[model samples]
Target: MTTATPHHLPGTDLALEQLPKVSLHDHLDGGLRPATIVELAADAGVELPTTDADELGAWFAEKSNSGSLVEYLKTFDITTAVMQTREGLERVAREFVEDLAADGVIWGEIRWAPEQHLARGLSLDETVEAVQEGLEQGVDAARNAGHRIRVGQLVSAMRHADRGLEIAELALRHRDAGVVGFDIAGAEAGFPPSRMRDAFELLAANFFPATIHAGEADGLDSIRGALTDGRALRLGHGVRLAEDIEVSTEGDGQVARLGRLAEWVKDRGIALETSPSSNLQTGAIAQWGTTLADHPLDLLYQLGFRVTVNTDNRLMSGTTLSRELALVADEFAYDLDDLLVFQLNAAEAAFLPVEDREALADAIIEGFEKAR
Candidate 1:
């Protein structure tokens, strides 16, 4: 969609973007086009750091790459600012889907906190409807363009805020519409999933799915709370769950000793929505190492964990789903087969009906075979 073409796997003619993929942890507020931001900001009278689209895009990348949590978070403030009105939300959501389709995403779960988009006086219900409209429009547009894609909203509640129960109910209310699940996002350190236990309990009672943001800005204890208290079906950026793993060298080779928490996650087949670039920018993988090569994703995958690659924040991280996969493949020497595993992992972990997930799995297999 942007100027950049789909990246090909090194040493192969296969274009990574041509493969079917599923995105579980992508944020709606984090994937806006820089040009859209400028136009939206201009209409809303919101001043930006720069008016040039290229410069604005670079600005987002610069702040997100600064390694300061505060600076990284400020980028969202700019994005959410432009998405307050119904029209803005709808347009952004529509473009989000088009971009995902262009990146060869067959299925995507877009997560964003509705509470952050209420500045224009839209009620929670209205906000959800507005986004759903945009998503549907995007789907139709993508289909017309010969790109078959499906998307569902993962209605997110800000963890630092006290609206978890309200957001969870909204998600359930719209379950038949466009929302697929509920999630609690935003700051992950001090605010544990336990803070939203009541909301999670409500979702559990209603048989609604949820994926809690855990172990990204926090540690294993937070992840434990996500499972025990939040009852998350999948973990958003659970990259830090690797903290429970202890790797050591022996006479013949190396071995990874999994702690109780890590073992539980691995044995349970809980999907880890890992975004390589975002994890590095947010220091989620700092405890493991400094670069993508040092990321614990490879370790988790080798240990038989359900590790699905993602682009947590496309605009902020300056990446697409394809780019994310390509980056990981380069870092870990992953071939087409390894890449297929990641897509299949995501397909199985998608919060969809059992039949739908199976169909998605079949599609992935077919697409990968064709790409090969």
Candidate 2:
């Protein structure tokens, strides 16, 4: 299921797919290969609306673009159904890495809710093991293909569910087995991270890192709880944090004033995992506009926030790391240096050890310098 490297873009001389990158917020379930999904569905006796890969891909895009969160979430239902078995999860996870490597991602964090995969009778531990096995194989495959890539797992707990504590422990249990972090990612508005305070506390006590979904479907309050209660080291699509900043165009220069929350986030260097296309699909940037150009990423970037571009759901958004960066570059007039900064920001914010993170940063700098 590895994607072929795209050689050239339609109207540009640059091949964005050729640039080195880091993917910090990609989801394992959200990046499945369409053809694989169809095959898996047939094997599992699960029904698919469309069996053709091209049509199925369009179906995802159309449903996600419906601007309804409920409709968007329905897509995951199909993906998760086929992933009930160990084989399904392992294959998907392995292909996820191969696809990332083909897209030029040097490092990535693949997040998924292990709790959701137990419906077919797999234990929580088994689910993690399955995905970890896939990731290891994927890494080896990529290496054999002459592409160097590293990936880690971020086990997520469904926010509305009451298994946060269990999921947190599951993540910590497999800390040495490829699970690198914890997260709470379902509906973000009503189900704030505070609901999982005890889970976050356990992670904190265990010295486990976490990132929460905030500022996408919710506002600053969800973000506050993510930082204060969840102790999130990074935010999943924290795009709405822009609500806390006011930009005033004065006589000569523009004056940007940060609210207390914005000031705290910026000062603390909490990474904003902004996924532009997904944000638009989910109406996370409704206050701004209905296009990539209207995203507040540039503002956050200029204001010193640790802004990183991501493809929240590659299938739903019909995007890649390269396409997301191209979209942002077109919107913000970002040069190769700016693109390098985002990759470096993500590498620094990754849940790796300091030495490993430093290595990742060095790799990014070298790649970008070569590209320039």
Model 2 scores a TM of 0.97
Residue 271 deviation, candidate 2, in Å?
0.4
Which runs in model 1 stand beyond 4 Å of their true positions?
1-3
Encode model 1's per-residue lDDT on 1-372: one tens digit a residue: 444776989788888878989999899999999999999999999999999999999999988986645567888989999999999999999999999999999999999899998888999999999999999999999999889999999999999898899999999999999999999988788999888889999999999999988888888898999999999889998988988998899988998999999999999999999989999998888876789988999999999999999998999999998999889988889999999999999999999999999999999999999987
Candidate 1, pairs of clashing residues: none
**TM-score of each model, in listed order:** 0.99, 0.97
Candidate 1 lowest-lDDT run of ten: 66-75
Give the TM-score (vs. native) of candidate 1: 0.99
- Over 1-372, each residue of candidate 2 has an lDDT whose tens digit, in order, gives 366556433345778777778999998999998999999999999999999998999998898986655567878999999999999999999999999998999989999999889988999999999999999999999889888899999999998898999999999899998999999988777898878889999999989999999999889999999999999999999999999999899999999999999999999999999998999898989899998888899999998999999998998899899988887887777877788889999999999999999999998888777665
lDDT of each: 0.92, 0.90
Q: How many clashing pairs in candidate 2?
A: 0
Q: Clash number for model 1?
A: 0
